[model samples]
Target: MAGFFKRIRAGLNTTIGFYLLVVVLFWLKTYLTYRTDFTLGVSGGMQQFLLLVNPIPSALLLFGIALYFRGKLAYWLMLIIDFLQSTWIFANILYYREFSDFLSLGIIKGTGNVQNNLGKSFLEILRPGDFIVYLDIVILILLLLFKVIKIDKRPFKFRYAFSITILSFLLMFAEYSAANANRSGLLTRTFDNNYIVKYLGLNEYAAFNVYQTQKESSTRSKAKAADLKSVQSFIKKNQVSPNVSYFGKEKGKNVFIIHLESFQQFLIDYKVDGKEVTPNINKFYHNQHTIAFDNFYHQVAQGKTSDAEMMLENSLYGLPQGSAMVSYGSSNTFQAAPSLLHQAGGYTSAAFHGDVPTFWNRNNTYKSWGYDYFFSDSYYKNKPNYNVGYGMKDKIFFDQTIPYLQQLPQPFYAKMITLTNHYPYELDKANTDFPATQTGDSTVDPYVQTAHYLDQAFGEFQQYLEKSGLAKNSVVVLYGDHYGISNNHRPAIAKLLGKKSVNKYDLAQFQKVPFMINGSNLDGHIDHIYGGEIDVLPTLLHLLGIKNDNTIQFGHDLLSSENRQIVPFRNGDFVSSQFVKSGNTIYDSSTGKELDLDNRQKKLLDEQQRFVNDSLSNSDKVVYGDLLRFHKLKGYQNVNKKDYDYTKKHALKQLQQSDRKHQTSLVDQNGGKSTVPDFKTNAPELK
Candidate 1:
């Protein structure tokens, strides 16, 4: 035992042994960060193994280059490279803690303001646990400084160094193969950053992001007007004629788009222990003035809420891999609803949400969309206990929003995003008297309580709007952003839905989301329309009396008799009035059974599939190629993003100036009195 200890200690003193030590330390740091700090969403043993091995090649490749040098220079280079890699991991750790996202290459190269982006001070970014990253480095430095270790002067042959570098490249390719085999399209159809970081190391993910960004920039530079020719032709050929009766029904009215987070359609009148889940929204669905769609689905994938927003505003499909909103929204040219209504009609547009402006890259995207103002989390008090899931509780959010709503210029296009009903549905007891589902799944139970709380908040806000008189003048539209219960919790979902099992077709049906629109003097009926998030823009455009004949929108007005009810989801699968295509097997939409199709029916299905594929491909071309920049619209101009700013100070100034100039604000109409006191919430956080 004594001899073994001596030999081990002696070997560690050598330069090669020290290099190996650095590699092992880097690997440990990365794996530990994956397990402890960051959530790359490791699912099973395969994913765990992938995460375990992905860090090996980067650590080897980075430190192995130092082996080509000799003596102190080699050791110093290895140490510096190790430190820089650690710094990057540390930055992502701090960033992931706040945004639940890795630091983008844009953020890394653009600013030194980490504190500003994370909403943390310099010291707050550094937690006590973070010191673990530097512990190994500190120990090595101390050993060298105290003369406990001597610099090694051994000659590392060229063949050995070359072999190490080559081994790294080979191992990296092997890792990519394993990742793709585990999950096909792991790289090509990249969905979440977490998947990339999990399958490949953080260093590899960073490299891929740089490559993607450069590729997109090059594509944009090479874009031309001719690229939009096919897209324009397809859109014009398939345009739906508007219904004369419904056209201009809500023209010149204030447009209110309520973004309901993680809300699904089944929750309407869904009972938990004989209590309603979303009673208020249910009531509004049956309201005399509300046109509700029972078959509306939210077509979202990796982008989720951001994807829904992209389709809602632009009438364009989100990218298949990642969110177009975060990937291209800042730079892409959008003929969006906000700008169309603002330019074509004399309307002011604003978006209100209790989250950070940087969430979904909305701060820049909103500017590109020609929004007059964006009211983000900084505008609200956001006091302690006020934030639950993503941002401020919905009740508190709506209450805080009333003041801003009153201040916006009248006939405004306002979108308020609610956050209380988000996933991992947690809530303080005071805010919800509704009991959670007794199911064993922790993530699936509290959903009802949070959803019920949102319903209460919506009810309170609607009544307040009525009392404040904004309800009478505004076209209030509310829609669920996406599904709260994912497919993984199928057993629990089946039990709640009183189903023996939820098969693939049933799961496809589960994608249905709630969509409704209401306005004064509108004899609203339940429209049995098969539509998705894509159809929202054209439908709203027609109602608002905005002409879009020359535009390149892919969606049709839901009210139009000629609307092709072919709703393509983010994935290749699509839903239609007659059938639901899950993978390759088409199921009868009503019965959820495989279709025994005749010859003509098969031909029709094939043609429908082709249309869906082309729609997705053309949308991708328009986005990646940025085809809109070259095409000119008659009355439209590119949004001067420089004209808009969403900071607290500038937003306030902009609102006040617009109000002074127009004198048509709600506050101005209400005799210069604020409507803040009218709205109330039972949120115990407020108490």
Candidate 2:
């Protein structure tokens, strides 16, 4: 053992061995950071294997460059490489903590804005253990000081260095080919960044992000106004008229949109151990004052919840690649719900989310969308006990926002986003009264409990609204933003669902999310009309007695008898009442059997596919070209970017000032007090 140790030390002291050592150390640190810090979707053994092998080529390519030089110059170059690489990993760690997203070159361009927005709170993003990433440099410096590693006496050889560099590149190409074989077009196609990082590595994703950003930028520059004509024409031709019975039911009523994170339709009446998972929502769905859609699907793409938000607000499809909020938000021209309602119906608009203003760039995007105020994380008590994975726990979020909601002017459009039932679903154990599932997967057990907790919170909030008299004149809207459990967890979820087998079609069906609207004037019925997030804007606009004609909305009123039932997903897949098309496979919606489409069916599918393409392309052009600036809609007023200030302090102050000036706010009418005490909840966190 002593002899082996001596030989190892002797080799490590040599120049070549030092280079290998530094490269290995760097890869090890990055791998550890990936496994520990970021949720890069390492769910199974295959993903873990990929994560292990992914860092090899990048580490070699980076550290190998230092090998071409000898002595102090090479040593310094290796150190610089180490510093830069570590810095990249550290930045990603901080970014993932806040956004649950990977960094992109386009987003990083706003570094100054991000830093300025975060202020001192940015320091909170750093964990104490993050300092461990620098320990390798400390060890190396100590070794050099102790004369354990000395500069090599040999002169540099370019031929040897060049061959090693070539060998590294060849190995990378071979590995990439193997990965693509496992998942076809793995390298070429743009996918969710999680898949990229899971299959490749962070370093590879950075390089790929740069390539994608440049490609997209080039496409944007080449986009022409002529691109707008086709999209506008298609929207105009396909637009549906509003149903007379539902056209103006909720006109002049306050709008309260509740965005439920990760709450799926499957949980509507689902039970485990004889206890309902979402009892409150189930009751609300069947209420006489509520209208609910059973087959409603969230049409979010890579942006997930943010994409759903964009689609709901703008009646436009989210970008196929990345989040429109993070990618095109600052630059895009939106004809959104807030702006449209304000201009057309004399409504005031505000949004409440218990998260940092910049999570999805809502701080900036809301301004462009013409929201009058935004209440973000600063307005909430986001302590660890009150806050969970994404943001504030549901009970606290709802309980605290009553004051702010009361201060909004009459006929206000307000949105409140809840966050307890987010992905990797976990809740404080004391908070849940529900029993666990018999399924062996521990990961699936907590989902029901958390969802139940969210339901209870909602019930409490609903009672408060009714008691406070706000429910009399408010249209309360509820919807799930996107899927909670990913396909990777489908097997376990299937077992819990009592399915013999679950396939992609089953998964797609499981993508159904709850969509409901409750109001005193609404004649509650189970509307079988199929719709997605994009259809929400026009549907709600029609309810407010605002016509969507002459507007650039791509969706139709769901209440319309002529509402289009075809729903196109972002990935070129689509679902209709009769068929579910995924990639090249077509399935009968009733039987779930694969179908060989006849000529007529084929033509219809092809046309639907083309419409999907044209719609997406046109939406992208509207965003990229800022075409809304070119055409003025009949009643729409151009959103003065200065109409809103997004700071929580400023927003609250504005609400206070409005309350004083008008003295007509609900809180002022109730003698200048908060109604939070009216809310009741069984949330264990509050205990």
Candidate 3:
């Protein structure tokens, strides 16, 4: 035993031995972090083993770079590289804690994605054990300086270094092959970070992200005008004709888009103990002034809220991988609603959210969309009591927006992003007294409380609009961004839905979210329209009497005679008026039973599937190929992102300067006086 220990100690004193030591430590540290810090959804013995071993290839490939150096410099180089890796890991740890997901390459290069509230959020996420990520580095540095682990003053042979590099390549190939065998086409299939990190380590994820970024960049770089013709042809072929009954009904009306975060359509009139959960939203949803879609769904992928926003504003699908807003919003050209409405009609576009401007890269994304003003958390009277887990409390957010909302010009397009009902559904007791569900689910129980609070806030907002007279001239649209309850809490969801079990059909139904358009002049109808978020832009354009001729949009207006209403989920799963396709099986939409495939039924299903597939593929092409950059709308200029700024000083100054002569704002129209005093709310947070 003593002889073996002595031999190991002697080997450790060599430069090659030091590199091996560093690699081992790096691999171990990464594995430990993966188990402790991240929720990669490792399952089965195979997945567990894969997760355990994924770090080695990256560690070997990276640490082996120091092998080329001679003497003590090699040891120092390894340690320095170790320090950088540690820093990167620690940064991800902080980010992952808050977002429950890994950071993307775009975030580092974002205008505010990395910098916005980074200090406060990062410090809050930092735990005592987080220091351990770098503790090994500190120890290794000290050991090297103190000469406890001596570095051999020998030069590495060229063959030895080359062998190490080649070995890393071999290991990487094996890991990738294993992952592919486990999940076919693991690299190209999905963009969900958990799947990526579960199969491959963080280093490989970063490499993949860089590759995706470069691929997108190169595709855009090599894009030609001819590349867009096919995309345009596809869009034109699928073009939906506007319905004569509802076309241009809400013309010249102020458009208010209220984003109900984490809300599902089942909650529309859902009751607990004979009491409505979202009383206010339920009221607006069913009222005679609203055009409600009972079958509307949100089509979001890994991008979530940002994806919803992209589909709503630009009528384009988000990238199958990472957020298009984060990846392409800064540089990609867009014919978004904000810019389109502004240029087509004399309307100002604004987005009001209580969160930081950088959360979904909305700071830059909004600029690209040509929003004239962005009323973020900074624009609100932010108090300690007013804040919630995600951002400002819903009631306070609505209450604070009175002044900003009043200042916006008439016929303006404003999107209000509510945040109180966000994930982890933690709401302070003071915010609402709504009873928690009896599901005993940590996630599902408290969801009602936050959702109820959002409802109350929405009610107050509607009342205020009526009192302030904004309701008379404005058309308000409400939508749920994405699914609040994920598939992980199946037991709780089944209990909540009063089902014995939650199957794929039930999960498909869970994707439904509320979509309503309320306006005083419009006839109310609860239309059973099977449309998704992608259709929002075209619908709104038609409502506003704006013609969308010679433009490329993947979605059709819901109130259109020609709309076939085939809503495709991000995962290629689709729900139509007739059938719901989940994985390999198809279910009847009306019966929720698996289709007994007759020859005719099979043929019809196959045709619909092809249409859904083609629509998604063409939309993706528009984004990846930057086809919009080549396809220009007649007399409409693409948005200049630099012209818009989200800062408080700049937004206010521009609003005042530009609207000085026009006197077009609601406040200007309300006798050149503030109408905020008329708005009333009983929010406890305000008190």
Candidate 4:
């Protein structure tokens, strides 16, 4: 026993013990600083201290055991374990949804300070004060004490090395199992069974079990096909095609649609530095027949960027529940805005983005959307690489589009998606044309500078339009795709603002992005209609003097007096809407609200539900390839007068036959049973 004690003591005096002590102390210091952000009362303090200290004891026990048995091999093994654990933890935290939200701390209530401080580069913010210097020193001292005083005399051992290798393998296996368990649960909840199995790699046995359960549940509660058919019939009967005046008449007009990357409304506010940050956009807003939707909101689902694009162009609702862009990309049949316009008005359309077309499977989606051509980073020539984080410079993007515009036929629709304002706002020095100012952090300054530069680029584009004589005959629309939130200077931002709020939603202004429309031929007056990205296509169609069947649109035109209000829906529920008529009653999905069904309210609700069902069903079909193949559906030619008479009769006969067969099939399927539940009697009033 005495000799054993002597051996343990000797091991503690080795370099292995020294490094383990250093790491533990460092972790402890970091945890302490983390806890200081919140003031813990006595009991809370004790709990926190214990929580933080428990890891130390556990680590020490493992380290001590390894050191006593393994010697030199144990030390190297411990280092490897520490590295793996730290890397995993950091990756987990970084990728977690909540991490990007730290940018909201700097936003003032009234000022539109939408500039994200989160997107700055690592080196730009790397400085002496960037780390907790005092805590670091304390950790160093603890490490030195363990190394020099306690663990300097230990010798190497083969047995200890073997023990560490086995332990490390076990530890890694355990960690991986825990991570996989959580991921599996998350995937099952979010995605369909087939999707989970194919894209998420769920084992066949587990996936089959989930599939069987879902299938049984669906069978028991599924709406009858007959009832769905009746609902569709009702919608078709009540559906009125909008006789929009501005749609097809404005021929030979160039249409420019700029989808700004993360340009939120909060960023539109003039800063205190006497410089107008978004001057170009503000100027365009004032000079055009603009409608600034103060209550505009985005319904960002899984594919935040692509969702915005789909909603804006196609007037489609947000992505279906549990749709990850990666998985959804594999499916090729999603209907969208450009295709509809192409079919209706013979408008030549092209889509451009400054990133790789394949980034979000946009190349496929765009091709499916009837875009005559798609331009991306590869499309541009002699372009300066702007390390603006995401892609080519917005300035160069606009410049490249100019030649294309001049060469294209009249009355073309060009969609330009900018990238200079993407996250990690710090523009690579190679990308920026402006001189960087000292803003304590090099990255933050570049972001602000990039915004200024983007504003300039927009102005130049506008000038180009005017110079080319297309300004007077062009319709221009601009909006942000999503908000940026990826910077490391969040702590500093919180300190600068004297508040500690995190996440963009916590800040009301982060959701607001500028949506504006300008056209010289149109009236120069502002419309205060509430709208969102979903309304953009309908509104644009209205402005272009092009009227479609309108039965397909879930969104209303801003210019239409019949439905002037916009109702924003997000996450399987309505967020806000002027069109939703309520009688001193609030309808919330989370907190049940008893929907008081007054006559008007009932009518509106019924209409909305019908619209929702049709849209959802059709959109689902479109996305899943049950509808026409997106790529093949293009190149539709309109019949001339001589052929129109014959074609019209044939079309009418086919439509009638199709409708009759569809109804008969529904009747056979459901025995003519109504699936519409009696809302007044069956469902409880949502409070």
Note the Cα lDDT for every prediction shown: 0.83, 0.79, 0.83, 0.50
Per-residue lDDT tens digits for candidate 1, residues 1-687, read 999987866877887788888899889888999998885557789888999989999888999999999988988888899888988888887766533567766555433321123343224446789868877788778877886777788867879888999999999999999999987887675355777898898999889988876776688788888989999988888888899999999999999999988899989878988988888999999999999998899887656688899899998888654567777777888889899998888899999988878777888888889898899888899687998866789988988888888988878999999988876576887787998887676668888999989889999999998889989889999999888887656788788778988877887888799999999868979998799998999999999888778887878899999988899865567898888987546898877889889998889888877778778878877989988887799989888888888888988988888899999998899899888888877767777
Show the lowest summed lDDT stretch of 10 residues, model 1.
Answer: 113-122
What is the model-wide C-alpha lDDT for candidate 4?
0.50
* Model 4: per-residue Cα lDDT at residue 615: 48
Which portions of model 1 miss their true places by more than 4 Å?
1-214, 596-598
Better of 1 and 2 by lDDT: 1
Q: Which scores better on TM-score, 1 or 4?
A: 1
What TM-score does candidate 1 reach? 0.76
The C-alpha RMSD in Å for every predicted model, in order, reads: 6.1, 6.0, 4.6, 16.5
- True-vs-predicted CA distance for residue 426, candidate 3, Å: 5.5
Q: Estimate TM-scores for all models.
A: 0.76, 0.77, 0.82, 0.57
- Candidate 4: list runs displaced more than 4 Å: 1-89, 97-252, 318-326, 383-387, 428-446, 485-506, 548-551, 564-574, 577-687
**Candidate 1 at 379: error in angstroms?**
2.0
Candidate 4 lDDT tens digits, 581-635: 2222335322334455678866766666445445454444344332323223334
- Give the least accurate 10-residue stretch of model 2, judged by summed lDDT: 113-122
lDDT of 2 at 479: 95
